[model samples]
Target chain A: MSDRSLSELGEQGLLPLLQAFCPAEQRGDDAAILTPPAGQQLVVSSDVLVEGIHFSEATTPPAAIGWRAAAANLSDLAAMGATPAGITLALALPSDRRLSWLQQIYQGLDRCLKQYDCPLIGGDLSRSPTATLAVTALGWVNPNRVIRRSTAQVGDWIMATGTHGLSRLGLGHLLGEWTLAEPLRDQAIAAHQAPKPRLDVVPLLARSQPAGTVWRVAGMDSSDGLADAVLQICRASQVGAVIEALPLPATTSFDRDRLIQAALYGGEDFELVLCLSPDWAQALLELLGEQAQVIGQITEKPVVQLRLSDRTEILSLDRGFQHFTTH
Target chain B: MSDRSLSELGEQGLLPLLQAFCPAEQRGDDAAILTPPAGQQLVVSSDVLVEGIHFSEATTPPAAIGWRAAAANLSDLAAMGATPAGITLALALPSDRRLSWLQQIYQGLDRCLKQYDCPLIGGDLSRSPTATLAVTALGWVNPNRVIRRSTAQVGDWIMATGTHGLSRLGLGHLLGEWTLAEPLRDQAIAAHQAPKPRLDVVPLLARSQPAGTVWRVAGMDSSDGLADAVLQICRASQVGAVIEALPLPATTSFDRDRLIQAALYGGEDFELVLCLSPDWAQALLELLGEQAQVIGQITEKPVVQLRLSDRTEILSLDRGFQHFTTH
Candidate 1:
C-alpha cells in the first residue's frame, strides 16, 4: 500500500505480493506443474523488454509496459495458431523502484492474461540498475493445425489482420514527432501502449478452412512492421511477394508517403501477417469481414517487390527495427 | 570471426549466430513446439541474473555467466525431481559488447545444456545498458512422484546433497575477501563460478525408496544457503527442525565457527535439502556414499534449532542472502 522502494521491501517481503499473482497451490514451489491438453502440442516463446529499448518511463505507464510485454509473447502464440496456456515472467528492477509501480505492472499483466485465458504460473525477481522484463509464454495447439512461417506456397495470398501505421503514429504522437485530432490521437496512443494480440482470430482461421480439406497456412506476428514480417516469410519459405498495397490505417493527418513509410518500417504493430491459398483467403476475409485484408500475394522471384500504380520497388530488409542500430 | 559490436552485426546479421545454439528445425519460428513425454507433467521455472547484482564482469567470464544463469533454472527443475526437456534464453546486452563475447556466452550455455541433455529451443535478444540473462527451463515429472517443500511430516530426517561452504568460500576468494591454498582455492573458485545442479542425485533418491512403497519426501534447492532452505521447508510444512551438524567440507584453513557460519549463511550452493523417513535416509546415505549426509531432523515445535556440543541456538531466516539488501 505504501510507495516504499524495493530495497525497503527486500526479496522476502516482495515474494508474498508476487505469489498473489499466481495460483495458490502452485506458489511456494521450486517450479510450477502443468499438464498439456490432450491431442495438443505445447508452444513456447520468450521475449525481453528493456527499460530504454522497448519502453520509456517518460511516455509509458507501468501498467502499459506490463500489458505490452505480455502482449508481445501472446502475439507470438497467435502467429503459431496456438491457444494460450500460461506465462512466466523473469523480472529485474532497480532497487529504487516503488512497490506501487510493480503492483500496477502486475495488474496490467493480469488483465492481458485474463483476457486471453493465460495464467501467471511462475516468475523470478532480481535487482538491477535498469528494469528488464523477460516473459516466456506457453500455448497449446493440435499438431496438425500448428502454423509455420516456412510453408508459404508460391500462389498463396498474403493477408494481414487489422490496419497498420496506427501504432507507429501513436508512438510519433507520444514522442511529439507528429500530431492528430482528438479520437484518433487517443486511439493511436492506446494502440502503441497496449496492442492486442490476434489470438481471437486463430479459431476463426480454422473455421475458414473447408471442412475435411487440408491447407497449409504460413504466418507470423508483425511486431517489427509489415515489411520485415513479409521479408522474413519470403526468406524462410524461399518465395517472393508482390505487395499490391499497404494496409494503412485511416489517418488524414499524415501524407500518403509518410503513412506508407510508417506502415512499412514502423515497429510493434502486433498484427498477424498470414499467407494462404486464394480460396482460404476469401473464406477468411468473408468470415472476418473488415477485420482482415489482402495486402499482397506470394511469387517465385525470391524478392519482395512493391507494385504500386506508377512504380515498382524492392523493400529492403535493413530498414526496420534492429536492436543495436540507430534507425 | 570478427570482434565487431552487435550494432555492427545488427539483428538480422546476428540471427544465424544465435540460431546455431538452438535446434536447427526450431529456429526461425514464432514459437517452438514441444511434446511432453507420455504420462508426465511439465515442470517450468524462470530465473534472472543481472550484472553488478549477481556477478561482476571483472571476476566472472562471459561463458560462466551464461552457464551459471542456466544452472540456476536447472537447479529449480532438479529440486522438483524433473528431467529437463528444454531451455529458452532471453538475453539483453549493451550494444557495445563484442560479438565474440556473446558467442562465448552462448558456448557456455550450450555446454551446460548439452551436459544435461537439455536442448536450446528458443530465445530473444535486445539491447540494454546493463547485461541481463533470463532463462526459462522446462522439465517433465510423474504427477505422483513430484517432490514438494510443503510435504515434510513431523519426525522426518533432514538430509542434504553435497558439502556446503565451498561455494561461499569460492565467492569470498573471488571477491578478495579470503585466501586459501592451491587445490582448495581452485575448487572454491570453480564452485563459485560454476555450481552444478544436483540433478544426478534425483534418481538415486528414487532408488533409495523401497520398491512399491509410496513416500512423501519434501525437498528444495539450497541456493539461498542451507539454513534458509531449512527455514523455508519448516514454514511451508508447518514443522520445525533441529540441525545436528553443518555439512562442512574438509578444510583446515578456517576454524569450526567460521566454517559453520559459511555453511549456514553463504548462498548459491545449488545443493538439495530434503526431508524423508529415517529408513529412506539410511538407504539414500548408502546409495549416495560421500555425496550426501544426514544433517538434522524435523520436529513438532514451530522453530528451527541448531544443536551443538556446547549449546543450542535458533537459526534466523533473515541471515541468508536477499535481493536489494546488503549481507
Candidate 2:
C-alpha cells in the first residue's frame, strides 16, 4: 500500500523524519540555540507561500514548492548582503497530505539549506485547509557592508544580476498558455520551479569595495518583476530611474515585445537589482563578468521612466505583482 | 459601506498598517538588521495557528487569535529561559478579510510584544483560502543558564508553575461542551482565548541558582498537557516519573476526577513544567510561593506512574495531544 496520510501518521510520528534534516543536537528542543557570528549583525526575514495563490500543485512539484519557499526568503537575505545562518519553517499541511509528499518537501528544503551552509533549526507543523509554508531565515552580515534600498544617490548606475522573463515564460508553459521547443522549454520550467537566489554576487560586491572605505549600495531582489524592484528602490531613495534597456534571456524563439513585458512585470525572477556609484559599479561588473549588467541610471527627477529607442514613457508604480489582485 | 478587503488594499497598501507596530528605522528593508546581546546565545522558535483547527472565529476573537499566536511562541522561549528579542509574523489571510480585522490582530500582537519589550521585526503577507498566522520569536539566553529537557537527573523533583486545566475548561466552555457559571466562565474564556506565557518565571529560575553556578534544570512549556510535558522530559532524559499529586485550580464547581483528568491530559496551558535538584526546587517554590507546586519526581523505573491516595496507575504514553489526529 501507499504511505500513510498525515492524519494517520500524526504529528508525533512525523517528528523523526523532520528531525533527520536538522542537526541532532539542535533537534528535540523547545527552541534551537544559535550563536551569532562574532562582530556581525543578524539579518532576519520571513516569507509565506500558499497553495493556489503562490503556486499550484498541478504546476509545481512538492519538492519545488519547498525549494521555492526557501529560495524566496534566501533571496531577501541576499538583497541585504547577508550570509545565511539558519532557517525556521512553519508548515501547515492538509490532513490528507501524503507522508511521501512532505518528505520530498523536506528533502528539497534540505538541499537548498545544505547549499547555503545552513541548518533547518526549528519550526512548527499543524493541520490546515490548504498547504502553507512560512519560512524565516536568519543570516549575518558585516555592519559596514550591509546593503539597503534607501541609499541610492543621483548619478549612480543601476545594474541587475542574471536575465529575467524565463520564470514567467516557464509559468506560462506550465499553465498551457503556450508551447516551446526543447532546451529553452526545459530551462524555462526549471527557472520557474527552482529559482536561485543571487547570493554569489554578495561576496563579489564585498570584494569590489576598498578595504577601509564604507560600502554604500542600494539593492533589492527582483521577486516582483525587475521594473517593480527598480521603482521600489527609486521611491525609497527619493530618486528616479531611467531604464534604457531590459534584461532578456538569450532566446530567439519568443517575440521581443512579449519578452520585454515579461521582463518588466513577470515577477519571481529572484535576481538582484542594484544601484551604486559608477566606479563601484564598474568594479563589480569587472568582478562579476557577464553575470551582471548595467541597464539604467539613477536620475534627479522623481519618476520612473522607460526610455526605448522610439519613445520614453513613465512606468506605473502599481504594475508590480501583488497578493489578492489579478495580474 | 464596510472597510476595504485585503484584495482591494493589496500587499503594498497593507505595508503602512503593518509598519505601524514595528520601528520606523527597521521597517521597509528586505531584512531587518539586529544586533545580538553581548555574550548570549540566540534561542529561536516558531509556531503556526490555522483557522478551524487551532481556533474558530465563533470562539476566538481576532485580537485573541493574534495574542495567542504570539504567546505560543513566547512560551517556547520561556522554556529555554531566554529573554525576548523580537517577533516576526507571517500572515496568510483570505482576500475578503476586512482591514479592521487585520488592524485588531496587529494591535493584539503589538500589545503582546510591547509587554515583552520586543518589537515586530519583519514578515510576509499572502492570500490563502483560510486565515493562517505563523510567528517566529527570537530570544537571548546566557550560555551557562540555558535550560534543556534532556538534563533531568534521576533524583530531581518535578514541579510546575501555575494551576492546570483552566485553559482546557475555557476551551470547553467556548465550544459549548459544558456551561460554566459567571466569574469562572469569564475566567475560563479569557484563559482559552488569550493564554499568557510564563516569562516571569524565567528570571526567578535564573536567580534560584547561586552566583557563578551552572543551571542543571530540565524544562519545557506545558502547551501540550502537563502529563505530556513530563513524559517528554522523562523520555529525553531517559528517566521515569512518579506523580504523587495533581495541580488543580481553586474551585469546587467541578468533580475531583474530572479536574484531575483535565489537569493531566488537557493541553494549551502555556505553563512551565520543570525538573530540578531538590534544593533548587525548594528555592523556586519559595520564590514563586502559591504560583508553583510540586506534583512528581524523577524515577529510575523508566515508566510514568500516577500514585493516588486510593489507587496507582501507569499513564499511557500516547495520551498526549497530537496534531492531525482526533483528540
Go through the candidates in order and give the clash count of each.
Answer: 0, 0
lDDT of 2: 0.89
> How would you encode candidate 1's per-residue C-alpha lDDT over A162-196 as one tens digit per residue?
98888888888888887877888888889998899
Tell me the lDDT of model 2 at A122. Answer: 86
Q: What overall lDDT goes with each candidate model?
A: 0.90, 0.89
**Which regions of candidate 1 are displaced past 4 Å?**
none
For residues B1-327, what per-residue lDDT tens digits would candidate 1 score against the true structure? 659999898888898989998888899888899997788898999998898988887667998888887888889999999989999998999999999999988998889888889999998999999999989999998888888999998989999999898888887778888777877898888888888998898888788997767968899999989999999999999999999977898878776776788889887889999999999989999988888999999999999999988668999888888897776
Interface RMSD of each: 0.7, 0.9
Per-residue lDDT tens digits for candidate 2, residues A1-327, read 679999998888888878888898898889999998788888999888999988997789989988888888899999999989899999999999999999999988888878878889988889998899999999999898888999999999999999998999999999998897788899999999999998999999978875565689898999999988998899899999999987889888888888888888998999999998888999999998888899999999999999989658898758878886766
| Docking level for model 1 | high
